[model samples]
Target: MAADTTEWKIKKLIQDLKDQYSKTVRNNPDTVAQIESAVRILSFLVAGRFENGEILSELIYSASNLLVFLNDSVFKAASKYVSKVVNVTKEKIKRWLTVLEYTEVFLEMAAKKKWGTKGAWIVITIIQIMKTALRFYVLVKLDGGIGSTPAIQPVDREILKTAEDEHDNLEDAWDEEAAYSAQEKTFTLQSSGRQIRTLQAAEPGMRTWGVPESGTQSPQNSVLNRKRKMLNQPASKLTKQRKWAEGLHIARPMAHLISMYISGLDSWKPFLLACGMDVTSMYLMGDTKDLNAKEKAELKRRNMMLLYYLMRSPFYDKYTKMRFIAIFRFIAQYVPLSGFIIRPLLEYLPTWQRMYFYVWTL
Candidate 1:
């Protein structure tokens, strides 16, 4: 009976997808091609044709691209009732799609450009696609039961239980710490007040003057005496103080090492280049009152050359390559000619990769 219900749900999902496609994307040939590619890829997956990691990777990548295309085209036009039922909005779906497409382009560039070989590209692409698909699938499946049984399973219950337990533990610990600190503070204040009163009662003669004599052993005078005694002590007695200062000096280098590890100082060049490209692309495509036509042309020329150099550079990692692709996609949306210039070089990329560029440029 459960098997039958699951089958029914899958069938309904497919029918709904078909209906959406017909309504929004049936008129576009390019969109039809994307749909066909997605269907073919999914069919392969269902048939267990993805026997190896490479094929499995391609299938997952294709699925992601398909999902993105559907979200942007079909789901974007979905009715409020349908969208609410699915618990997904057009804008939300678009953002996810953008991220997937950005990632896809990045991997594609990393594989083809950085590696400089089709075989290397295919391997890297497959690994990245698999990783991303697994992450997204786990998140969606665990969070909302997407394409799964709606009833909370034992695993889901355990996850919820763990989260609740952690939250309760944290709350309890904080409350206990706060209460202890408050009590300690109150006790200290009471002890200090009692000490002040005892000293005032014992020295009635000094209380009338409103000031303690310089020689009097008041709290302030005691603190000064302690400091003076410490400063005058032999070097052997100050071993702990010297050790503490040495530790602080050592911590400076340790902190620098930690900062380097966290900030990835060695990888800063690629990060900087990515940021520069993104900024430059935005400026060229955006309204700029500061630059004349000649200046803009000169900047555009330099920008194009820099983009080409980065695309051909082998030094960039997959993440850096993705940033470049994202920047290009953004620029291509405003400057159609930019897409044409790079089309020939990227002809060897997958259909989905090419389609992504075409879709944005269009």
Candidate 2:
């Protein structure tokens, strides 16, 4: 063969790694579940970043969903066909979950629309209700839901990625002239070129195997604990009353939209009602001991989301909007040239508050 190329070697190495990884994922059922769970959560969070770059938001959301689909459905199906070792029930639930994710981008886009008469509100409402219902059956009844799922936390990566490169140079990193002079003066039969070549060798390390490693079982303990919590979750603990409270909590957006369309509730009532429902659900979900690790985390999240309502309407219009307008006007008085910039933002504030602001945060 002609001399091997860098690009070709890299491609071959990548393909080999991919094949090995696929086989490992297939052989280990736990890895499959872990990957699927990660993909679902990633897809869920991918749409949260929507600033001036809305199109990028759509692309990332779609890409995350594609990852979810591949892990949840395609990979498992292929694994089952090839190895005949797969968790069929879990795979089926994952497939359904993958299908639910298909609407992620569409729902997010609709939620951001400024037009109330365009029917996005009603469509989003219905979709949320139906999706939640199926999510319960598929996620809880069939598979380990969010609680049993493990999340991968990034450690040191941000610091590492941003850190300046550190180096201790020897003859290796010098210019060709300096490097060649540093090398051995022994003559060789090979033709010399202008640039010096570095030799490649296998990485130096000892990878001892066959002996079971310590700390491996600790992770399994966490997973088992989650499963045990799910199994031992008493019906009394999560009663119909609590369920109803959660239902009201989740239906907050739907009710908010419906009330606005009907022209019944005052401008502020919907937001307050939703806020109250959120509080009620939080109360009903109970203390740290009562709720699992996941629910506790979720409760904390909702608590944080309470701050979101400040940017929402009636609150925004009566309180925030007026304050902002006054500030802009006050600044414009001192700085006359600033009105050209501030005027458009002041005008767009109401529309953004109603349509984009709250939904974008979601």
Q: Highest TM-score: give the candidate number.
A: 2
Question: lDDT of all the models against the reference?
Answer: 0.40, 0.49
Candidate 2, residue 246: how far the Cα is off, in Å:
2.4
lDDT of 1 at 174: 46
**Which pairs clash in model 2?**
none
Off by over 4 Å in 1: 1-88, 95-99, 102-162, 181-277, 281-362
Off by over 4 Å in 2: 1-57, 65-116, 135-237, 264-266, 321-362
Model 1: number of clashes?
0
85: Cα error in model 2, Å: 13
Tens digits of per-residue lDDT, candidate 1, 1-362, equal: 99999999999999998886656552453565576567656643443233443334454555555554554444224322122223344235334534444345445534554466554446443543443343344333323111111011111111111233544675566455444422232322355443122243235344432322223344433444454343222212213333333223223223332443466544554335443543444443444344343334434553454454333223343444677566666776678688765543333233433322221110
